[model samples]
Target: MAASSAVEPTSFDPSKAYKEWEVNGKYFGDGREVALLDYIYNHPDIEQLRGNPEKILRAIDAFAQSVTGLINIGENKGVIVSDVIAQHKPEVVLELGGYIGFSAIMFGSAMKRAGGKQYYSVEKSPLFAAVATSLIDLAGLRDTVRVVVGTGAEGIQRLYDNGLLRSQIGMAFFDHHKPSYTADLKLCERLGLIGKGTVLVADNMILPGNPPYVEWVRASVEDKRAMDKAAQEKGNPNLQYNSRFVKSFEPSGMEDALEITECLGIEGA
Candidate 1:
Protein backbone atom coordinates (compact mmCIF):
# COMPACT_ATOMS: atom_id res chain seq x y z
CA MET A 1 0.00 0.00 0.00
CA ALA A 2 1.10 3.58 -0.66
CA ALA A 3 1.20 6.47 1.77
CA SER A 4 -2.41 7.73 1.83
CA SER A 5 -3.28 11.16 0.53
CA ALA A 6 -5.62 12.75 3.05
CA VAL A 7 -8.60 15.11 2.88
CA GLU A 8 -11.30 16.15 5.32
CA PRO A 9 -14.52 14.15 4.98
CA THR A 10 -17.71 16.07 4.37
CA SER A 11 -20.53 15.30 6.79
CA PHE A 12 -23.38 13.46 5.08
CA ASP A 13 -27.01 14.35 5.71
CA PRO A 14 -29.04 11.19 6.23
CA SER A 15 -32.21 12.88 5.04
CA LYS A 16 -30.67 12.98 1.57
CA ALA A 17 -30.08 9.23 1.38
CA TYR A 18 -31.33 7.16 -1.54
CA LYS A 19 -33.21 3.90 -1.18
CA GLU A 20 -30.53 1.55 0.08
CA TRP A 21 -29.02 -0.80 -2.47
CA GLU A 22 -29.54 -4.57 -2.26
CA VAL A 23 -28.05 -5.97 0.92
CA ASN A 24 -27.79 -9.73 0.34
CA GLY A 25 -26.98 -10.48 -3.27
CA LYS A 26 -27.30 -8.31 -6.37
CA TYR A 27 -27.00 -4.54 -6.40
CA PHE A 28 -27.43 -4.05 -10.18
CA GLY A 29 -28.40 -5.68 -13.52
CA ASP A 30 -31.55 -7.40 -12.25
CA GLY A 31 -33.89 -5.39 -14.57
CA ARG A 32 -33.61 -2.17 -12.54
CA GLU A 33 -31.64 -0.62 -15.40
CA VAL A 34 -34.46 -1.14 -17.86
CA ALA A 35 -36.84 0.00 -15.14
CA LEU A 36 -34.88 3.26 -15.02
CA LEU A 37 -35.44 3.70 -18.74
CA ASP A 38 -39.15 3.08 -18.25
CA TYR A 39 -39.27 5.48 -15.34
CA ILE A 40 -37.62 8.26 -17.31
CA TYR A 41 -39.68 7.85 -20.45
CA ASN A 42 -42.85 7.64 -18.39
CA HIS A 43 -41.90 10.71 -16.34
CA PRO A 44 -44.57 13.38 -16.51
CA ASP A 45 -41.88 15.93 -17.31
CA ILE A 46 -40.35 13.83 -20.08
CA GLU A 47 -40.96 16.65 -22.53
CA GLN A 48 -39.07 19.05 -20.25
CA LEU A 49 -36.24 16.55 -19.81
CA ARG A 50 -35.40 16.52 -23.50
CA GLY A 51 -32.36 18.68 -24.19
CA ASN A 52 -32.12 19.53 -20.49
CA PRO A 53 -29.19 17.78 -18.81
CA GLU A 54 -29.80 19.06 -15.30
CA LYS A 55 -33.48 18.08 -15.38
CA ILE A 56 -32.58 14.64 -16.65
CA LEU A 57 -30.08 14.29 -13.79
CA ARG A 58 -32.76 15.37 -11.34
CA ALA A 59 -35.10 12.73 -12.69
CA ILE A 60 -32.43 10.07 -12.27
CA ASP A 61 -31.85 11.20 -8.71
CA ALA A 62 -35.61 11.07 -8.09
CA PHE A 63 -35.75 7.47 -9.24
CA ALA A 64 -32.79 6.50 -7.08
CA GLN A 65 -34.36 8.18 -4.04
CA SER A 66 -37.87 6.74 -4.39
CA VAL A 67 -37.32 3.60 -6.40
CA THR A 68 -33.89 2.03 -5.78
CA GLY A 69 -30.29 2.98 -5.25
CA LEU A 70 -28.01 3.42 -8.27
CA ILE A 71 -24.26 2.90 -8.37
CA ASN A 72 -23.25 6.32 -9.55
CA ILE A 73 -21.19 9.35 -8.74
CA GLY A 74 -24.32 11.25 -7.70
CA GLU A 75 -24.41 15.00 -7.10
CA ASN A 76 -21.78 15.39 -4.37
CA LYS A 77 -18.67 13.78 -5.88
CA GLY A 78 -20.00 14.61 -9.32
CA VAL A 79 -19.72 18.33 -8.62
CA ILE A 80 -16.09 17.83 -7.63
CA VAL A 81 -15.17 16.25 -11.00
CA SER A 82 -17.44 18.66 -12.84
CA ASP A 83 -15.44 21.51 -11.34
CA VAL A 84 -12.24 19.87 -12.57
CA ILE A 85 -13.63 19.71 -16.12
CA ALA A 86 -14.59 23.38 -15.95
CA GLN A 87 -11.18 24.41 -14.67
CA HIS A 88 -8.98 22.13 -16.83
CA LYS A 89 -11.14 22.45 -19.95
CA PRO A 90 -10.16 19.06 -21.36
CA GLU A 91 -10.47 18.78 -25.12
CA VAL A 92 -11.34 15.10 -24.97
CA VAL A 93 -12.23 12.86 -22.04
CA LEU A 94 -12.35 9.10 -21.60
CA GLU A 95 -14.48 7.29 -19.05
CA LEU A 96 -13.86 3.65 -18.07
CA GLY A 97 -17.42 2.98 -16.93
CA GLY A 98 -20.65 4.35 -18.39
CA TYR A 99 -23.25 2.76 -16.06
CA ILE A 100 -26.65 4.23 -17.12
CA GLY A 101 -24.96 7.41 -18.45
CA PHE A 102 -25.50 9.41 -15.25
CA SER A 103 -21.94 10.67 -15.27
CA ALA A 104 -22.00 10.91 -19.05
CA ILE A 105 -24.99 13.24 -19.05
CA MET A 106 -23.57 15.20 -16.14
CA PHE A 107 -19.94 15.39 -17.18
CA GLY A 108 -20.63 15.30 -20.92
CA SER A 109 -22.83 18.37 -20.58
CA ALA A 110 -20.08 20.06 -18.63
CA MET A 111 -17.45 19.11 -21.23
CA LYS A 112 -19.56 20.36 -24.12
CA ARG A 113 -20.11 23.64 -22.28
CA ALA A 114 -16.36 23.90 -21.76
CA GLY A 115 -15.85 23.52 -25.53
CA GLY A 116 -14.66 19.91 -25.39
CA LYS A 117 -14.80 17.83 -28.54
CA GLN A 118 -15.48 14.28 -27.39
CA TYR A 119 -16.44 12.15 -24.38
CA TYR A 120 -16.05 8.39 -24.78
CA SER A 121 -17.67 6.15 -22.17
CA VAL A 122 -16.62 2.49 -22.22
CA GLU A 123 -19.07 0.11 -20.56
CA LYS A 124 -18.53 -3.64 -20.32
CA SER A 125 -22.14 -4.76 -20.47
CA PRO A 126 -23.95 -4.30 -23.76
CA LEU A 127 -27.23 -4.03 -21.88
CA PHE A 128 -25.87 -1.32 -19.62
CA ALA A 129 -24.39 0.49 -22.61
CA ALA A 130 -27.76 0.35 -24.37
CA VAL A 131 -29.48 1.95 -21.41
CA ALA A 132 -26.78 4.59 -21.22
CA THR A 133 -26.97 5.31 -24.95
CA SER A 134 -30.72 5.81 -24.77
CA LEU A 135 -30.44 8.20 -21.85
CA ILE A 136 -27.56 10.07 -23.45
CA ASP A 137 -29.65 10.56 -26.57
CA LEU A 138 -32.53 11.70 -24.42
CA ALA A 139 -30.21 14.27 -22.87
CA GLY A 140 -29.46 15.54 -26.42
CA LEU A 141 -25.78 14.75 -25.90
CA ARG A 142 -25.59 12.06 -28.56
CA ASP A 143 -23.10 14.11 -30.54
CA THR A 144 -20.71 14.73 -27.64
CA VAL A 145 -20.98 11.49 -25.67
CA ARG A 146 -20.30 8.15 -27.40
CA VAL A 147 -20.81 4.93 -25.47
CA VAL A 148 -18.56 2.01 -26.36
CA VAL A 149 -19.59 -1.46 -25.27
CA GLY A 150 -16.54 -3.44 -24.16
CA THR A 151 -14.21 -3.97 -21.26
CA GLY A 152 -11.86 -1.13 -20.40
CA ALA A 153 -8.80 -2.52 -22.19
CA GLU A 154 -10.77 -3.63 -25.25
CA GLY A 155 -12.47 -0.27 -25.61
CA ILE A 156 -9.20 1.63 -25.27
CA GLN A 157 -7.58 -0.57 -27.87
CA ARG A 158 -10.49 -0.25 -30.29
CA LEU A 159 -10.62 3.53 -29.95
CA TYR A 160 -6.86 3.84 -30.38
CA ASP A 161 -6.73 1.45 -33.34
CA ASN A 162 -9.61 3.33 -34.99
CA GLY A 163 -7.73 6.61 -34.67
CA LEU A 164 -10.41 8.10 -32.44
CA LEU A 165 -7.79 8.32 -29.69
CA ARG A 166 -4.78 9.05 -31.88
CA SER A 167 -3.53 11.74 -29.55
CA GLN A 168 -3.20 11.90 -25.80
CA ILE A 169 -6.39 11.89 -23.77
CA GLY A 170 -7.07 15.13 -21.92
CA MET A 171 -8.69 13.54 -18.90
CA ALA A 172 -9.76 10.08 -17.78
CA PHE A 173 -12.23 8.91 -15.15
CA PHE A 174 -11.87 5.43 -13.64
CA ASP A 175 -14.90 3.86 -11.93
CA HIS A 176 -15.02 0.37 -13.40
CA HIS A 177 -13.90 -2.92 -11.80
CA LYS A 178 -11.80 -2.08 -8.73
CA PRO A 179 -8.99 -4.37 -9.83
CA SER A 180 -8.87 -3.04 -13.38
CA TYR A 181 -7.81 0.48 -12.35
CA THR A 182 -4.06 -0.04 -12.46
CA ALA A 183 -4.19 -2.36 -15.48
CA ASP A 184 -6.36 -0.05 -17.57
CA LEU A 185 -4.26 2.93 -16.60
CA LYS A 186 -1.15 1.01 -17.57
CA LEU A 187 -2.76 0.22 -20.91
CA CYS A 188 -3.38 3.93 -21.42
CA GLU A 189 0.14 4.77 -20.45
CA ARG A 190 1.64 2.06 -22.68
CA LEU A 191 -0.45 3.25 -25.62
CA GLY A 192 0.57 6.86 -25.07
CA LEU A 193 -3.06 7.83 -24.49
CA ILE A 194 -1.98 9.76 -21.42
CA GLY A 195 0.79 12.29 -21.17
CA LYS A 196 1.64 15.73 -19.87
CA GLY A 197 -1.34 17.66 -18.49
CA THR A 198 -3.66 14.63 -18.59
CA VAL A 199 -5.87 14.47 -15.52
CA LEU A 200 -6.85 11.15 -13.90
CA VAL A 201 -9.77 10.86 -11.47
CA ALA A 202 -10.40 7.47 -9.82
CA ASP A 203 -13.59 6.85 -7.83
CA ASN A 204 -14.30 4.50 -4.91
CA MET A 205 -10.88 5.08 -3.46
CA ILE A 206 -12.10 4.92 0.15
CA LEU A 207 -15.24 2.80 0.02
CA PRO A 208 -13.03 -0.04 -1.31
CA GLY A 209 -9.56 1.30 -1.64
CA ASN A 210 -7.15 0.68 -4.59
CA PRO A 211 -3.67 0.58 -3.16
CA PRO A 212 -1.64 -0.37 -6.24
CA TYR A 213 -3.18 2.44 -8.27
CA VAL A 214 -2.58 5.04 -5.58
CA GLU A 215 0.99 3.88 -5.12
CA TRP A 216 1.79 3.88 -8.84
CA VAL A 217 0.48 7.37 -9.47
CA ARG A 218 2.14 8.85 -6.38
CA ALA A 219 5.46 7.06 -6.85
CA SER A 220 8.64 8.73 -8.05
CA VAL A 221 10.09 7.73 -11.43
CA GLU A 222 12.87 5.71 -9.81
CA ASP A 223 10.46 4.04 -7.43
CA LYS A 224 8.05 3.25 -10.25
CA ARG A 225 10.84 1.73 -12.31
CA ALA A 226 11.67 -0.59 -9.42
CA MET A 227 8.00 -1.42 -8.88
CA ASP A 228 7.49 -2.18 -12.58
CA LYS A 229 10.05 -5.01 -12.55
CA ALA A 230 7.54 -7.15 -10.65
CA ALA A 231 4.41 -5.75 -12.34
CA GLN A 232 2.68 -7.58 -15.18
CA GLU A 233 1.04 -4.43 -16.50
CA LYS A 234 3.98 -2.25 -17.41
CA GLY A 235 3.26 1.47 -17.48
CA ASN A 236 5.47 4.36 -18.46
CA PRO A 237 7.60 4.69 -15.36
CA ASN A 238 8.92 8.12 -16.30
CA LEU A 239 5.53 9.81 -16.50
CA GLN A 240 5.60 12.06 -13.48
CA TYR A 241 2.38 12.54 -11.51
CA ASN A 242 1.18 14.80 -8.72
CA SER A 243 -1.82 13.35 -6.93
CA ARG A 244 -4.15 14.02 -3.99
CA PHE A 245 -7.21 12.53 -2.34
CA VAL A 246 -10.66 14.15 -2.14
CA LYS A 247 -13.31 13.06 0.34
CA SER A 248 -16.97 12.92 -0.69
CA PHE A 249 -20.08 10.82 -0.06
CA GLU A 250 -21.98 8.30 -2.16
CA PRO A 251 -25.63 8.81 -3.07
CA SER A 252 -26.39 6.18 -0.43
CA GLY A 253 -24.76 8.53 2.16
CA MET A 254 -21.71 6.27 2.54
CA GLU A 255 -18.23 7.75 2.59
CA ASP A 256 -15.94 7.52 -0.50
CA ALA A 257 -12.99 9.32 -1.98
CA LEU A 258 -11.50 10.04 -5.41
CA GLU A 259 -7.81 9.87 -6.18
CA ILE A 260 -7.06 12.80 -8.47
CA THR A 261 -3.72 12.81 -10.27
CA GLU A 262 -2.18 15.10 -12.86
CA CYS A 263 0.64 14.04 -15.18
CA LEU A 264 3.50 16.54 -14.93
CA GLY A 265 5.21 15.19 -18.09
CA ILE A 266 7.83 12.45 -18.44
CA GLU A 267 10.82 12.93 -16.23
CA GLY A 268 13.73 14.48 -18.19
CA ALA A 269 11.62 14.70 -21.33
Candidate 2:
Protein backbone atom coordinates (compact mmCIF):
# COMPACT_ATOMS: atom_id res chain seq x y z
CA MET A 1 0.00 0.00 0.00
CA ALA A 2 1.81 3.14 -1.20
CA ALA A 3 0.72 5.29 1.70
CA SER A 4 -2.88 5.63 0.56
CA SER A 5 -3.21 8.50 -1.89
CA ALA A 6 -4.44 11.72 -0.27
CA VAL A 7 -8.05 12.41 -1.27
CA GLU A 8 -9.18 15.96 -2.02
CA PRO A 9 -12.74 17.18 -2.72
CA THR A 10 -13.57 20.14 -5.00
CA SER A 11 -16.71 22.24 -4.45
CA PHE A 12 -18.74 23.17 -7.52
CA ASP A 13 -22.01 25.00 -8.20
CA PRO A 14 -24.02 25.17 -11.41
CA SER A 15 -24.89 28.87 -10.94
CA LYS A 16 -22.00 31.27 -10.79
CA ALA A 17 -22.14 34.77 -9.46
CA TYR A 18 -22.47 37.00 -12.51
CA LYS A 19 -21.21 39.97 -10.60
CA GLU A 20 -21.75 43.32 -12.34
CA TRP A 21 -18.90 45.32 -10.88
CA GLU A 22 -19.93 48.69 -12.33
CA VAL A 23 -23.52 48.33 -11.22
CA ASN A 24 -22.56 47.29 -7.71
CA GLY A 25 -19.64 49.72 -7.56
CA LYS A 26 -21.67 52.83 -8.37
CA TYR A 27 -21.68 55.45 -5.61
CA PHE A 28 -24.31 58.12 -4.94
CA GLY A 29 -23.54 61.59 -3.64
CA ASP A 30 -24.61 62.40 -0.11
CA GLY A 31 -26.92 65.11 -1.44
CA ARG A 32 -28.50 62.72 -3.93
CA GLU A 33 -28.96 60.09 -1.25
CA VAL A 34 -30.55 62.60 1.10
CA ALA A 35 -32.90 63.90 -1.57
CA LEU A 36 -33.95 60.39 -2.56
CA LEU A 37 -34.34 59.25 1.03
CA ASP A 38 -36.39 62.32 1.93
CA TYR A 39 -38.57 61.82 -1.11
CA ILE A 40 -39.14 58.17 -0.23
CA TYR A 41 -39.76 58.97 3.40
CA ASN A 42 -42.38 61.60 2.66
CA HIS A 43 -44.10 60.54 -0.58
CA PRO A 44 -46.09 57.66 0.90
CA ASP A 45 -47.50 59.88 3.63
CA ILE A 46 -48.54 62.77 1.34
CA GLU A 47 -52.13 61.70 0.92
CA GLN A 48 -52.62 61.20 4.61
CA LEU A 49 -51.49 64.76 5.39
CA ARG A 50 -53.00 66.57 2.42
CA GLY A 51 -55.26 68.88 4.37
CA ASN A 52 -52.44 70.78 6.04
CA PRO A 53 -50.87 73.56 3.99
CA GLU A 54 -47.37 73.02 5.26
CA LYS A 55 -47.64 69.30 4.69
CA ILE A 56 -49.03 69.93 1.22
CA LEU A 57 -45.97 71.98 0.33
CA ARG A 58 -43.68 69.30 1.69
CA ALA A 59 -45.66 66.71 -0.25
CA ILE A 60 -45.29 68.75 -3.42
CA ASP A 61 -41.52 68.88 -2.93
CA ALA A 62 -41.45 65.13 -2.26
CA PHE A 63 -43.62 64.41 -5.27
CA ALA A 64 -41.33 66.47 -7.47
CA GLN A 65 -38.33 64.64 -6.03
CA SER A 66 -40.02 61.30 -6.64
CA VAL A 67 -40.67 62.16 -10.27
CA THR A 68 -37.10 63.32 -10.65
CA GLY A 69 -35.81 60.09 -9.08
CA LEU A 70 -37.68 58.02 -11.66
CA ILE A 71 -35.19 59.16 -14.28
CA ASN A 72 -32.35 60.93 -12.39
CA ILE A 73 -31.59 60.93 -8.70
CA GLY A 74 -30.87 64.63 -8.23
CA GLU A 75 -32.29 68.01 -7.48
CA ASN A 76 -34.72 69.19 -10.17
CA LYS A 77 -33.99 72.05 -12.55
CA GLY A 78 -37.51 73.33 -12.09
CA VAL A 79 -36.88 73.78 -8.40
CA ILE A 80 -33.79 75.82 -9.17
CA VAL A 81 -35.61 77.89 -11.76
CA SER A 82 -38.42 78.51 -9.30
CA ASP A 83 -35.96 79.59 -6.67
CA VAL A 84 -34.41 82.10 -9.06
CA ILE A 85 -37.81 83.44 -9.99
CA ALA A 86 -38.73 83.75 -6.36
CA GLN A 87 -35.50 85.53 -5.60
CA HIS A 88 -36.06 87.98 -8.43
CA LYS A 89 -39.66 88.48 -7.36
CA PRO A 90 -40.71 88.60 -10.95
CA GLU A 91 -44.21 89.80 -11.75
CA VAL A 92 -44.68 87.46 -14.70
CA VAL A 93 -43.24 84.02 -15.43
CA LEU A 94 -43.52 81.96 -18.59
CA GLU A 95 -42.65 78.29 -18.61
CA LEU A 96 -42.34 75.93 -21.54
CA GLY A 97 -43.27 72.31 -20.82
CA GLY A 98 -45.42 71.58 -17.84
CA TYR A 99 -44.84 67.89 -17.14
CA ILE A 100 -47.13 66.18 -14.68
CA GLY A 101 -47.28 69.52 -12.80
CA PHE A 102 -43.92 69.21 -11.05
CA SER A 103 -42.55 72.45 -12.44
CA ALA A 104 -45.94 74.04 -12.14
CA ILE A 105 -46.13 73.20 -8.45
CA MET A 106 -42.66 74.60 -7.88
CA PHE A 107 -43.44 77.73 -9.86
CA GLY A 108 -46.79 78.15 -8.16
CA SER A 109 -45.22 77.91 -4.75
CA ALA A 110 -42.64 80.51 -5.70
CA MET A 111 -45.32 82.75 -7.13
CA LYS A 112 -47.41 82.36 -4.02
CA ARG A 113 -44.50 83.50 -1.91
CA ALA A 114 -43.55 86.34 -4.25
CA GLY A 115 -47.11 87.62 -4.16
CA GLY A 116 -48.67 89.19 -7.27
CA LYS A 117 -46.71 86.99 -9.62
CA GLN A 118 -48.52 84.97 -12.29
CA TYR A 119 -47.27 81.87 -14.09
CA TYR A 120 -48.18 80.67 -17.56
CA SER A 121 -47.00 77.16 -18.39
CA VAL A 122 -47.25 75.81 -21.91
CA GLU A 123 -47.26 72.06 -22.42
CA LYS A 124 -47.59 70.20 -25.70
CA SER A 125 -49.05 67.07 -24.19
CA PRO A 126 -52.74 67.36 -23.46
CA LEU A 127 -52.68 64.46 -21.03
CA PHE A 128 -49.78 66.02 -19.18
CA ALA A 129 -51.50 69.36 -19.16
CA ALA A 130 -54.64 67.80 -17.73
CA VAL A 131 -52.64 66.13 -15.02
CA ALA A 132 -50.85 69.43 -14.30
CA THR A 133 -54.14 71.28 -14.10
CA SER A 134 -55.51 68.75 -11.63
CA LEU A 135 -52.40 69.00 -9.54
CA ILE A 136 -52.50 72.78 -9.63
CA ASP A 137 -56.06 72.72 -8.36
CA LEU A 138 -55.16 70.26 -5.66
CA ALA A 139 -52.28 72.45 -4.59
CA GLY A 140 -54.75 75.36 -4.44
CA LEU A 141 -52.65 77.34 -6.88
CA ARG A 142 -55.03 77.43 -9.82
CA ASP A 143 -55.41 81.17 -9.46
CA THR A 144 -51.67 81.76 -9.65
CA VAL A 145 -50.59 79.25 -12.27
CA ARG A 146 -52.24 78.46 -15.61
CA VAL A 147 -51.38 75.38 -17.63
CA VAL A 148 -52.02 75.62 -21.37
CA VAL A 149 -52.01 72.55 -23.58
CA GLY A 150 -49.97 73.40 -26.70
CA THR A 151 -46.46 73.93 -27.87
CA GLY A 152 -44.95 77.16 -26.57
CA ALA A 153 -44.72 78.63 -30.05
CA GLU A 154 -48.33 77.90 -30.82
CA GLY A 155 -49.40 78.72 -27.31
CA ILE A 156 -47.67 82.09 -27.54
CA GLN A 157 -49.75 82.90 -30.58
CA ARG A 158 -52.91 81.81 -28.81
CA LEU A 159 -51.94 83.77 -25.74
CA TYR A 160 -51.30 86.85 -27.85
CA ASP A 161 -54.61 86.35 -29.60
CA ASN A 162 -56.25 85.97 -26.23
CA GLY A 163 -54.60 89.19 -24.98
CA LEU A 164 -52.54 87.36 -22.38
CA LEU A 165 -49.15 87.85 -24.01
CA ARG A 166 -49.39 91.62 -24.17
CA SER A 167 -47.89 91.95 -20.73
CA GLN A 168 -44.09 91.86 -20.53
CA ILE A 169 -42.78 88.49 -19.38
CA GLY A 170 -40.19 88.95 -16.68
CA MET A 171 -38.88 85.40 -16.49
CA ALA A 172 -39.00 82.49 -18.92
CA PHE A 173 -38.16 78.86 -18.27
CA PHE A 174 -37.16 76.57 -21.15
CA ASP A 175 -37.39 72.92 -20.13
CA HIS A 176 -39.16 71.35 -23.07
CA HIS A 177 -37.65 69.37 -25.93
CA LYS A 178 -33.97 70.29 -26.19
CA PRO A 179 -34.06 71.19 -29.87
CA SER A 180 -36.88 73.64 -29.34
CA TYR A 181 -34.99 75.71 -26.79
CA THR A 182 -33.32 78.22 -29.08
CA ALA A 183 -36.28 78.39 -31.46
CA ASP A 184 -38.68 79.12 -28.64
CA LEU A 185 -36.37 81.77 -27.19
CA LYS A 186 -36.12 83.41 -30.61
CA LEU A 187 -39.87 83.25 -30.99
CA CYS A 188 -40.36 85.03 -27.69
CA GLU A 189 -37.69 87.56 -28.60
CA ARG A 190 -39.31 88.22 -32.00
CA LEU A 191 -42.63 88.74 -30.30
CA GLY A 192 -40.99 91.18 -27.86
CA LEU A 193 -42.60 89.25 -25.02
CA ILE A 194 -39.56 89.23 -22.77
CA GLY A 195 -38.96 92.50 -20.98
CA LYS A 196 -35.68 94.18 -20.23
CA GLY A 197 -33.72 92.38 -17.51
CA THR A 198 -35.66 89.22 -18.27
CA VAL A 199 -34.20 86.02 -16.92
CA LEU A 200 -34.32 82.99 -19.21
CA VAL A 201 -33.42 79.61 -17.78
CA ALA A 202 -32.68 76.57 -19.92
CA ASP A 203 -32.57 73.12 -18.34
CA ASN A 204 -31.11 69.73 -19.35
CA MET A 205 -27.96 71.24 -20.74
CA ILE A 206 -25.68 68.48 -19.42
CA LEU A 207 -27.37 65.08 -19.36
CA PRO A 208 -29.84 65.35 -22.21
CA GLY A 209 -27.44 67.96 -23.66
CA ASN A 210 -28.25 71.03 -25.79
CA PRO A 211 -25.01 71.62 -27.60
CA PRO A 212 -26.67 73.45 -30.46
CA TYR A 213 -28.14 76.10 -28.20
CA VAL A 214 -24.99 76.27 -26.14
CA GLU A 215 -22.86 76.64 -29.25
CA TRP A 216 -25.17 79.28 -30.62
CA VAL A 217 -24.88 81.27 -27.44
CA ARG A 218 -21.12 80.92 -27.47
CA ALA A 219 -20.92 82.04 -31.08
CA SER A 220 -23.22 84.95 -30.40
CA VAL A 221 -21.08 86.03 -27.49
CA GLU A 222 -17.93 85.72 -29.57
CA ASP A 223 -19.44 87.78 -32.34
CA LYS A 224 -20.47 90.36 -29.80
CA ARG A 225 -16.93 90.47 -28.47
CA ALA A 226 -15.66 92.41 -31.48
CA MET A 227 -18.52 94.88 -31.20
CA ASP A 228 -17.87 95.15 -27.48
CA LYS A 229 -14.21 95.91 -28.19
CA ALA A 230 -15.24 98.53 -30.73
CA ALA A 231 -17.65 100.01 -28.21
CA GLN A 232 -14.89 100.17 -25.62
CA GLU A 233 -12.64 101.87 -28.20
CA LYS A 234 -15.40 104.42 -28.75
CA GLY A 235 -15.37 105.24 -25.01
CA ASN A 236 -18.54 103.26 -24.44
CA PRO A 237 -18.50 100.64 -21.69
CA ASN A 238 -17.91 97.16 -23.11
CA LEU A 239 -21.18 95.29 -23.56
CA GLN A 240 -21.55 92.82 -20.75
CA TYR A 241 -23.57 89.63 -20.55
CA ASN A 242 -23.53 86.78 -18.08
CA SER A 243 -24.79 83.25 -17.64
CA ARG A 244 -24.95 81.15 -14.49
CA PHE A 245 -24.71 77.39 -14.53
CA VAL A 246 -26.49 75.42 -11.83
CA LYS A 247 -24.95 72.09 -10.89
CA SER A 248 -26.77 68.80 -10.41
CA PHE A 249 -25.57 65.55 -8.90
CA GLU A 250 -24.72 62.75 -11.29
CA PRO A 251 -23.64 59.20 -10.45
CA SER A 252 -20.28 60.04 -11.98
CA GLY A 253 -19.77 63.57 -10.72
CA MET A 254 -21.40 66.97 -10.45
CA GLU A 255 -22.74 68.25 -13.77
CA ASP A 256 -24.34 71.46 -14.92
CA ALA A 257 -27.87 70.75 -16.07
CA LEU A 258 -29.34 74.21 -15.87
CA GLU A 259 -28.21 77.48 -17.45
CA ILE A 260 -29.74 80.60 -16.01
CA THR A 261 -28.91 83.33 -18.47
CA GLU A 262 -30.22 86.83 -18.14
CA CYS A 263 -30.77 88.99 -21.20
CA LEU A 264 -30.40 92.66 -20.50
CA GLY A 265 -32.19 94.45 -23.26
CA ILE A 266 -31.21 97.95 -24.34
CA GLU A 267 -33.23 99.55 -21.60
CA GLY A 268 -31.85 97.40 -18.86
CA ALA A 269 -28.33 97.57 -20.25
Q: Largest lDDT belongs to which candidate?
A: 1
Reference-based TM-score, model 1: 0.97
Q: Write the per-residue lDDT of candidate 2 for residues 121-154, one digit (tens) a residue.
A: 9989776677567656766788888998899889
Residue pairs with colliding backbones in model 1 are none
Reference-based lDDT, residue 45, model 1: 92
For model 1, residues 88-158, the per-residue Cα lDDT tens digits are 89999999999999999999999999999999999999999999999999999999999999999999999
User: How many clashes (backbone N, Cα, C below 3 Å) per candidate?
Assistant: 0, 0
Off by over 4 Å in 2: 1-79, 218-241, 250-256, 267-269
User: What is the Cα-based lDDT of residue 43 in candidate 1?
Assistant: 97
